[model samples]
Target: MLQSFKCEACKSNNQPSVSNHKDNSHLPDCKDEISLNTIGVIKTMFLEKRAVPRQASEAARIISRIELNSRIFNNPEHSLEGLETFSHIWILYYFHRNQIHLKSKVAPPRLGGERVGVFSTRSPHRPCPIGLSLVQLDRIDNGTIYFYGTDMVDGTPVLDIKPYIPQYDVPRKIERQEFFSPREAPDGEENCESVKTASTSTSGNLVSNVTVPNWVTNCKYLSVTFNETAEQQLQELAVEKKSITEILRADPRSVYLRTKYGSQIYTFQLGENTVTCKFDDQNSIVNVLQVRKVVILGDIPVSDDE
Candidate 1:
C-alpha cells in the first residue's frame, strides 16, 4: 500500500519556509493511501537490465508489443475503440526493476557523469518509480498494441495508455539558439553561445524561455562498426544489422560503467542471441566483437514422439 500525507504549509497563503520545513509541527496527520493496477504488460527484446536504452526514443528501430489483461476487460476489442488513428501513443509503466533509493540529484550518462537535479534527467530512480515513454504506434489487434521504440524490460507492467496529439503535446514558438559547451569553451571565456533549436512561450504558464547548460545540448553519440566475424555471425543468425547499429550508436552503458570501467567488453542479449562488443572510448567507437545464440541449460528438448 502506498501512503501519502498532506502538509499544512500547502494550506497557508504565504510561501513555506524551506529551512525548517522538515521539522515543523503544525502539519496535520491526514494519511491517504492510493492503489494502482496494471492494465497490460509490454513485450520487448530486452530480457535483462544490462543494455536497455535509457530513453525509448533512443531505440526507435526496436519494435515491441503490449498485451492487455483479458480478466480486467469485459470486451477487450471494444475497449480499444479508435487508438489506431494516432501515429504515436504514451505508455505509463512502473519501474518494477529499480532497486535504488530516491535521489535528489543524479548524473546522466549523456552529461558525462555531471551531477544535476533528479528532475532534470530522465533517470529511473525517482520518488514514485513510475516511467513514461512516447512510442510510435504500428498497429493494434484486439487488446494488443504493437509499437516502436521501447526501453522497458520484457515483462514491464503498463499502468495506462494515451494517444499522442501534437496540438496538445507540442508547444509553440520554437526557434534556434546558440550555446557553447563547457568542455569546448575557449580559454579565458566563461560562457559562449553555441548552436541548437529550442522553444519559448511568453503567454502560457510555461517558462518564458527554455535554457539549458551546454552539456545537455552538446551530447555526442558513439559510432558503431561491425567486424568481419560479427557481420558473418549476424547474417547466419538472420538478424537485422540496422537494428543492432541503432541500439549501439546510443551508447547504452550507464554512467557508472562508462566512468569507472572506461573501455571494456560489454555483452547484452539481443533477441535470442547474445551480442558482445568492445568500446573504444578514445575514438568514440563501438566495435562489435561477435554474436552467439543464448543457451538455456536446464530445459530438456521435446521430440515428436513425446
Candidate 2:
C-alpha cells in the first residue's frame, strides 16, 4: 500500500520521491495529465489582476457574479436546486492571468518582504494555476450566482462550486491535549506550544492543533483618509467611501512596488474609473487624492472633461 521510491534516471537519493500514498481503486490511473473544463465565468469590478484584493475578506464590500455555462450542464437551473440554502460557497477558479513560471519561494506582503516557501503563502503562481475562495452567497438567479467578498478579476474561469457546510468543511477540534517538538512544528512556526483541548467528541474525529505565523495572525492595516477634493469626487461618482476605505486599509501593493515606487502616486482601477492616492509613510496613512475616468489618448491618461 504505502511506498517510497525514485525513478531509475535520478542519480541522487535526495531527488523528490512520492511516499505514504495508500494505493486504492479511488485513485485515478492517469499517469501524466488531467483534463478540466470551465463550468462558468465570473464577473467582478476588478478588471485587472493588480486591482483585485489580496484576499476575499479584504474586499468584503465587493460583489461578484458567476454566470454558469449551460453547455456544461443538461439543465443548469436544476443543478443549483439545493444550493440556495447555504449562506456561503467555495469557488474554485483558474488563475488565468498569472505568468507561466514556478518559484520555490515567495515573499508575502505581511512579512515585510521575507522569503518563504511558495506553499506557505497563497501565491497564484503555483504549479497548477488554481484559486479557491469562500464568499458569502447573496442570491442565486436562474444560471447566475451572486456573491460578496471577491478577490477574483473580471472574466475569471470558474471550475467548480461547492456549498460551505461547516460540519463537513471545518476540521474537528482536538478532544485531547498534545504537544509537539519544534522540529515537528510547521516551517514558519517557531515556539513549541500545547494544543487546545476540546469538549468530549466522537473518538478519531479530532485534529491536532493548528499553528500560524505571528505575522499572519497580527495583520497591520493602514489608516485611510480622504481629502475634500477626493471626497467630493467620490460623491459625484456615487462611490461608497467605505468600499474605498476597506480596499486601502488592506494596502493592495506588491512588495516591489511599495519598496521601489514608495513615493509615487498609487493608482488602481475601481469600476470604469481610476482611483489615485498617496501613501504617507511617516504616518502610515493613505490619503486619497482623486478619482478620474480611465480614458487613454495614446500613452497619456485624460480626465472625463477632456
TM-score of each: 0.76, 0.78
Model 2: per-residue lDDT, tens digit, 1-306?
A: 225554543324344344533554433333466689999999998888875788898889888899999999977888898788778899999998887447888888888799899888888888778899999999999989999998999999999998775444566654335344124445334231222222233224544555678878898899999999899988888888888888988899888888888856888888778888999766789999998777878987666756
Worst 10 residues of 2 by lDDT: 190-199
Q: What TM-score does candidate 1 reach? A: 0.76
How many backbone clashes does every candidate have?
Answer: 4, 0
C-alpha RMSD in Å of predicted model 1 compared with the true structure: 11.8
lDDT of 1 by residue, 204-297 (tens): 5344455677777787788999999999988998988988888888898888998899899998987688888999999999999888877665
How displaced is residue 68 in candidate 2, in Å?
Answer: 0.6
Q: List the residue pairs that clash in candidate 1.
A: 178-194, 179-193, 179-194, 180-194
Model 2 error, position 76 (Å): 1.5
Off by over 4 Å in 2: 1-29, 176-208, 295-302
